[model samples]
Target: MQQTIEALRVALNKKRWHEARYALSRARALTNALPADVAVQEREQLSALRRMYAARNTPTAKKAQQAKSKAVGRAGGKKPAAKKSTAKSAAQTPKPAPVRDLGDRFINRANLGYGPTNEAKGSRTR
Candidate 1:
């Protein structure tokens, strides 16, 4: 808590370094047990408080965020764009078999001009 830190700060100011140190250590240990969002907000608030204490401009905080964004961008932004080789491919080589044309006759060796046989469904006479 701020009150505890303030009390510690007061103890330090009054030439009580050991007590202040102990209090600070206690505060530091307690910090880790804080909720995740609380830790983030605490970090964000610390920066804001530092800026405020320094009597800086409100726009300075915005600029700091922009600078952070710019830093992150610089880390990944300048990947050399990949270049595709635009040279055209040569025409495909012709097949070994003769290509079929409109006037060419198709020879189906598998079918061999054979068709399905029709079977009669009548009793055979002796």
Candidate 2:
């Protein structure tokens, strides 16, 4: 329907790819059900929209978009404000426990009774 085609056009203009794609699909479905004479114009428009979408998805277009953003960022764009410190004094704040080296503890697993010990591996005599 013309409404769907119009929706696709608006979406494309706004760079709303998901909406544009949905609208395009709907338009295609509507166009398919129409007679050849009525569908020709819609088919042409659909092809043009497809090409536009494809162009936007290309690497060059992506790079250009990134460059545009970078330019905007450099041109007086608002930077994130630094966070203010809390009211708590340094002495009032609880210190985190120091990290211990547990590497040596796990090295001798048999001594730690984790794996089979030497006595456990040997044959048991009554």
Candidate 3:
């Protein structure tokens, strides 16, 4: 039991989470073999050790490990050529003719005297 505890402490001091977890489990097993009171005391110590090691294995460290593996994967292979899509683009469809503007047509009608006339010489019935 003492040997396992010493191993766990050494592993923790070295900031080795995996080894610390292993030694902690071993220590826990050893404690279980001892008297109930002694086992309870060791269990508390084991729980503290678990928390300490868990805190050290931070999310940033996990992200860094993931990034390293991805980098290795990218470096280890030639990526296959990207496939060209067989679907035709909208550019292939003929565009509809532009709308004929009416403003110019209205101006042309006024100039040609085909639009509304002046009231001065207009003939009308009331």
Candidate 4:
């Protein structure tokens, strides 16, 4: 039982969640079979470990870890490459064709060839 609790602590410290969970379960099972005095102490340790596991697995904790990793960068000591500008000169870019007004009667361009030709001008009565 003591050995199992020790294993749980080590796993938790190393951030090995799966191993920690397994150890916690083993400790819990062992705790059930121990004497009343020893079981109480082991239960306290298990509860604390459970709290630590829950805190570490929370969404906010994961987000904080992700943000920290991004800030640190993954390429060891190397700096990230600078992004290149994709700006184009007016001569190299084509201007979009101007849209013509189809008048207020047209609800949508796609509806011109399909569905009802025109929609009601105002709210319809029952």
TM-score (all chains, Cα) for each model: 0.29, 0.47, 0.39, 0.45
The models' CA-based lDDT, in order, is 0.55, 0.78, 0.72, 0.78
TM-score of 4: 0.45
lDDT pick, better of 2 and 3? 2
**Candidate 1 lDDT by residue in tens digits, 17-68:** 5676676666566566676567675545444433343433357756986798
CA-only RMSD, every prediction? 17.7, 11.1, 13.9, 12.7
Ten residues in sequence with the least summed lDDT for candidate 4: 117-126
lDDT of 2 by residue, 1-126 (tens): 768878898999899999998998888788778888876777898889878877987999889889987776444667778876666564476888999876533244465577764565553322
lDDT of 4 by residue, 67-123 (tens): 987897565788779966566553476878999987554245334565543345542
Worst 10 residues of 2 by lDDT: 117-126
Q: Stretches of candidate 2 above 4 Å error?
A: 63-126
Q: Which regions in candidate 1 have their CA more than 4 angstroms from the true location? A: 39-126
How well does candidate 4 score on lDDT at residue 108? Answer: 55
Point out where model 3 deviates above 4 Å.
59-126
Error of 2 at 32 (Å): 0.9
lDDT of 1 at 97: 97
Quote the positional error of residue 61 for candidate 2 in Å. Answer: 2.3
Model 2: pairs clashing at backbone N, Cα or C within 3 Å: none
